[model samples]
Target: MKRKILLSALLLPAVMAFGQQYGGMWIPTELNEKEMKSLGMKISAKDIFNPDKASIKDAVVQFDGGCTAEVISPKGLLLTNHHCGYDNIQSHSTVENDLLTNGFWAKDMNGELPNPGVTVDFITDIKEVTAQILPGTENLTGAELTKKINENIEAYKKAQKTESYQTISVRSMYYGNKFYAYVIETFKDIRLVGAPPSAIGKYGSDTDNWVWPRHTGDFSMFRIYADKNNKPSEYSKDNIPYTPKHFLPISIKDKKEDDFTFVFGFPGRTTEYLPAIAVEKIMTETDPAMIAVRDVALKTLDEKMRVDPATKIKYASKYARVANYWKKWIGEVEGLKKSNAVEKKKQYEQTLISKNPAIKPTIDGLNQKYNEQAPYNLHKAYYSEVVRNSETLTLAGIYSNYIKAYEEGKMDAKNNEALKARLTEVYKDYDAELDAKVTAKILALYANKTPAQFLPKDFGMLKDANKNLGTIENMSKMSVITGRGNLNGIKTSDLNKLFENPKALVANLKKDPLVEMYGSFKSSYFETTDAKVTALQTDIDALQKKFMAQQMETDKDRKFFPDANSTLRVTYGQVKGSEPRDAVSYGYQTHLAGVMEKYVPGDYEFDVPKKLISLYNSKDYGVYKDKTGDVPVNFTATNHTTGGNSGSPALDAYGNLIGLNFDRQWEGTMSDINYDPKLCRNIMVDTKYILFVIDKYADSKWLLNEMKIVK
Candidate 1:
């Protein structure tokens, strides 16, 4: 029988059974080939993972959006999540030149705009540093063990130093029972290459974020220019193409059930090892709370943005950003409860505890800690938003701490140096204009809410936004919002100019009693959060140890791996199809016709420009057709995925990339809660759709000529 759509095998407390299935930093060399093959993988893990074999390295890129990406060219080229690059493309759109609303094309290679903050990560090499670092250690106590391990690592670093990359990350997998050192190559020379119009790119938008039977060409392109030697270097016209060892071959055919496939990328995090009770709390209380808050925020933003054509364009990116993940969270939460993930985990924990009383009390202790911390989370989210709008006292507090430490000469040399470097580096990404707009938007949101629901309670400081904002009692009515208003529908740049009296940053930071209240709140918040986190760490670390202990006993049937601890992790699942929440079954099937179905003629979400609609109307569907059928634009695979899996490379049996995994069909949005092979399928745009858009629609042959396409 196929795995039921069960995120958790059974319900149980997480502190007991939930932390077991978490596989940490699994080396590509270590994926269970035999098991993977049984799950329908045609290629061996070694085939896809071996950097020396075929072009796997060139096929892998760390998708900053969430998943991983790879260089498919010797020239600066990148392939990643369509959703990941969506907002980046939208950011370049504006009133007269709205790329997002009308969609964007460089018209030529030179027209490609340099994206400011986007960065692509390249994995240079990964090594098992166990023997080199943990030569003789075997389960030592917490502090002493950490000290000894660090000392060992420090000596190893000093003795065997070779600098090919800037940050060498050591990830503990199998619950800190094993370790892998990944040396990453980072490049900031990435630029937006091409993207389909929103009609094709974001087709479904809010109506289809995490749902299935999905048809969205969610893909984007970026070019990366390396130094003359093709090594990592700063952006320079003097730089040359980064000739990569491999690039994925474009296929116009769809995948089949049990068809051999693989994916390579940096998956963010997962909690496959959480105990049942903890899962329950999240599914029932925590997820519900987050959903409730996010819904209000998204609805408010959506309603307010539709006020005018200009306002809609101004807030387009903002609305998408808020709604995209808000629906995802809601779906996951709803899916979790429906799939009975929490309950399954609970039962699993009970079974473990019944069999092993030695670990029961400790597990129970962990459960107690999770319960105590859960309630404060809602307040934390609400207040966290408040804190971001206020002059960022968290960073300021840290700075103050650093100053105090420096004055006392008590700061460690390494930490002091790191702090200074980080502070300086942060300013490069800081935009005062964006900040003012975001600050105003959030403050205005709080300012407009009912007094009882007010978060910071204005204290008569915030000029009432109720009078300041454009008032329309019905936001969803859409047509009533006539676009004209004072500060209500004003542009951010215009608002900054209007509020140019003494600058809002310094004004809010130095605003008399408010500043003092903020300082006091910041101090209290820091102290409280620090103490709680510190106390929580003790148990959390203990939980980690317990997780590691179980993982060490994997004796072959299944190697117990620890869940992700905000550290690194590697989860392995074959490319397979699924059926989800609704009776919808996602297949390796998608048609270009669906793209036009997502078009709504001029609605912001459904806007279709005449030139593009002309092409579609001309029945000029390009080479996006599949071998099995014609007009295949998007497809689904039985690949297990989640939030962190975005931008992951879905590959064929030859270890070649097939598609970029982005989201799962809505039915399987609950895939994280329970990976249902029947209903939980990961969705991706066919690689051919990408090529067609680039070569035909966008007409950027320079970028297309770089890729390796196999007909």
Candidate 2:
């Protein structure tokens, strides 16, 4: 015991130092002020987030409910990643006016295009509500405890004082150990301001998505409009550009290695506290299963996209969304094994048990529950991946929802019209033949990979000859949901005809082959898998919460940051490169010269715009050129980030905007589950490059006039 104590005393400082340097997605209201200051932060914690007055947090908003964007000008000009705004860009693109290919620059506010449903949510306030939310549930567990917690939350929200425009939401932290209430104000009248063409904004494309030494510009610009009183309102021509409380000043000062930087955003999710067994399951089983399914889908989509320009245009956003996680999972599995995360977790668990033997059973119980849940979890992954990737089946699932509503006697005129509108949007970019081909391949792979017990009955017939495309084609053609032999499948015109007779439509859908198959799969999932998984998860969560409390109590020297749950967070580090693997040290940044090095005139991923090449030839980089005599593009930093951190502001020590957070280094994708400071790095597009593209490339210097530039 004495020797262990001495060893812990010796190691605690190093552990704390490492934690302070590279780990943690901290809550802004509960920042570790001393540690942040020690790590070279020049501003107070309150300057980053102060509910009493406007601060840096006022400028940051959740972009389109997923990514993060920051107000870069007093007139509410927004900056975020290109891919984060890809869907809207695709929506506005057409063969005649291809905004995605040629890009768009609003010469004035009158030229800006409004996006009807898109919104940016500003976090007005975040306060701990644990006392109010968890007080009445101390003696309860499982379903009863959940019920009581819901009741308490409803009461707490109802009692709060908030403006009519502001909404209150509560989220649990540390596996329900604590809670926080957020007051959010959402602005709906966002409009596109400017974006570089894909060749520039998405330079390097999928080939360079998560890799370091990236040269992609990866950014887009937008403006937020509001009513005359500067309050949130729906889109209207009468609205005006919002006047922001605080907006970040763009820092054009030369950045170097070890410059203090921080990312502020709404990070989606991270499970940093999972036990060793869960990590092993993810690395060995679940990730590989989903990857295999997406692998088949991507290969099919790539073949179609490569040969057809229209298909490429139609599927660009869908393909990116699919390929994003497909590649991330591949990297995550590799990182987990290379980092030896499972073994390290085991060692840590042993140490934790040693410190407090009483908590050993809780840890053991959590592991046991994971082991039991493993097969069900994998089945869940396979089911979800197949449905998500197969457009036909996905559409069928939507029809299934309509069928449910009809059966429940709740299919009012409003619901019917809503369904028609949804189907129209879904079928707009959908290619039935392409979906059929993808469905055949992925369904075959699913049947071959999934256990017989978990598969639906339709899949059982294909199990013996899973690769037979003829049988799959026949099965799909039998379904009216696939348009009953129509190569284009259900058209919007067909929908109008189908909806003319609601009762007949419902009757036909009940007999549809694809819908039946979808129903069976969903039924099998809920009946055979979901119930058991939910029960085991309830017990596992209870034990895990206790385990978390125990670990925090026993390991008093270690800093405990809550896992990300799509709430606002602040993760800080420095501008630095990484040696992702042996003998392969990546530089801290990439330049336009490197972009030309990778350029191929006619290649989809590497094509350079003629104007961009002309500017490069003339060396017309303007003030955005770095001291190194090149235009800096993307840079790597040690900041921790995940999915929702895309488009987050990478701020300098003085809270000036330096870069836009976009992707993580490939080897660091596993940071969602386990972070290694040495390998984990967030990739950001340098603000210099953003300004260069906007000014020199697009010749849109008018947009730059609005921003406050700190030279």
Candidate 3:
């Protein structure tokens, strides 16, 4: 029997029979222009994307490989979330000139700070090539099918006409039912132009992160430079500012509740089409376990950071990165339960099965498969969190990479040069005591939770050592390369020699109890990554793709958008408030008064600069104030967004920049797995407020003058 291949949902109409307003992240080239026009979009599809002409797509970029940014000036002035630029800001910071704390501004173009290795990519074109990608694969299954698809994709990418600086890649949509090839022009000489103090940019900090009614400014400015011909190039003193094909005009016009809004950028990932059983497992087992582990790590780091400023600086980035998803997972669990997402998914599945009984077996098998794999998945999650969260273990893993290089006889000049660079990267912000405390606690939790069969045999040694996690932690730290106790005495040349001799290197590494233990765990973990389990997952993935195709076919008339996979997409909605629970509601937008209300002097999270307070007191918002005479800080909308959408541009009907995407409301974090129109909302910093800070607070008039402002 031949496998059934369903129609591609990317070609479906945007209008839904259920009258659901703008929820899907649409491909600009494949968008239903009529639906957009009917829904009050002022621009045509071509106006958003036109390879042969300058359009909105030309202005958007994937910032630093993780976030999104938009060019706002012909000189390549880019706008993105402050947190997205946090690492760059922190790198330029020092004890004396703490840019993270005090902020930095370039007085002129010549003052802009160049960042090494930072790059921004713009999509030049997107072409639907499902036919080409999936040709003659109807009879294949599992890895064979995947291998063919990848091979086809590689062939297609290689055949594309691209410049030396441009690149091509293929992305799967609708699970694997559809494929779109993208041509991207990437600029490498991105520079830091200006950023507000942490007090303003990261205002409210972790405590208020992912929560609504937010007052965080959460905006940063940068510039992209190119060679004289405006082509992408490596950073050079002779490079000139990139003159973009298109730049978003800053809108300081008043925006009210129900204002039409859209976010255009990359959204990292979303499993909007998962089975109910998977959602349950994530909520019940994975989320809670991961959250608990992170909770322990956060407590340790927070305690140290509060007492010591140096420790605070050392752990700030790591703490924020960990806490972000920790808080999001907590909210996701809450939202999933609050909205009864599992029950809803089951209902949808029933409807799907009813529409086509052919899918019933697939759906039933998926539920059983998810249930059986739940523990194994949770075990993997726990192990991942334990190793990744522990600085000592992370260092061990880093050294393990070098050991492999030595054993392979690949630790020559190039690899050694890279290893030296890696060492510098590792030890720069490392805190040994903090790592030891975090590692000890987290490893103990993992041992307590993980099943015995999954535990490495060498872990028995830890159990025999009086069940003392600290003992294991201390032994590792004292002997590992990153251990402060051992660090100062060990020279760089010593590490160089270790890499030169595989036998001596193994001997030296074996002397460290933690290293040896980690080696055992890694080896044992690899042993347990059963091929059968992998085959089961591969079967599940193939089933999922079929299920996705069936879903599109069953709901052919309804708008079926693909899930986010770190691809450029356009999601539009209205500025709206969410009633998370009965009798409690959040307004759509926050104001300067709210910032002042939350202000606490000398408090790490809530403190604002005195200059900001004075401006608020004087109502010095200039023309950026809303109709009510308050500067809008941040606003919420029904736009469907996820991780990589951070720093995406929030555009108005006319495609003018009004806000910068930074986060989603806490209750809406579940939007990734399940989207609820009432509860789901993305939070964005109002461009007016960004302008107010740049022009008034930061006194960045020159930067303001560079942007194209529209009232």
TM per candidate comes to: 0.74, 0.90, 0.89
Q: Which candidate has the highest TM-score of all?
A: 2
Q: Scored by CA lDDT, what does every candidate get?
A: 0.57, 0.86, 0.83
After superposition on all C-alphas, the RMSD of every candidate to the true structure, in Å, is: 9.0, 6.5, 7.4
- Candidate 1's clash total is 54
Local error of candidate 2 at residue 198 (angstroms): 2.6
Model 3 residue runs over 4 Å out of place are 1-22, 32-39, 90-98, 226-230, 233-240, 302-314, 420-434, 458-470, 473-505, 530-533
lDDT of 1 by residue, 1-711 (tens): 121221111221222211123223344666655655654556555556555655365457765535566666656577766667877877888889877656666665566677766666766566788787676567676687778878877776666555564567676665556666766667766777777777677776766666555667777777776777777776766766567766666655555545655556565555666666667776676566545545555555555455646556665555665666567767777667666787776676566656555657656776887777654544454445545432323344444555456557665657755765655443333333333334334445433432432234332343454532222211111210111212334322332342243233333334323234455545644555545655665666668567446534432345444343332233444444444435533345565555566666666555565755676677666566555334556666555566666767677766556677777766556655465454456777777777767776777787767766766
Candidate 3 residue lDDT tens string, 1-711: 121211121222332122334367788887755666665678878889998999999999999999999999989999999999999998899999999999999999899998998999999988899999999788998778889999998888887788999999799899889999889898999999999999999998877888877889888889999999989999999999999999999999977666777899999988988888889999999999999899989998999998999899778778988998899999999999998999988998898888889989989889878777776778878888888888778778877877777778787888778877777776778776667778777877777787888888755444432355568656755674645434335543355554555576566676766677678777777677445457667767877888888888887667778888888999888777767766555677788888887888998888989999899888888898887788888888888899999999999989999999998999878989988777789999999999999999988898878889999
Error of 2 at 527 (Å): 2.6
**Ranking of candidates on TM-score, top first:** 2, 3, 1
Q: What is the lDDT of candidate 1?
A: 0.57
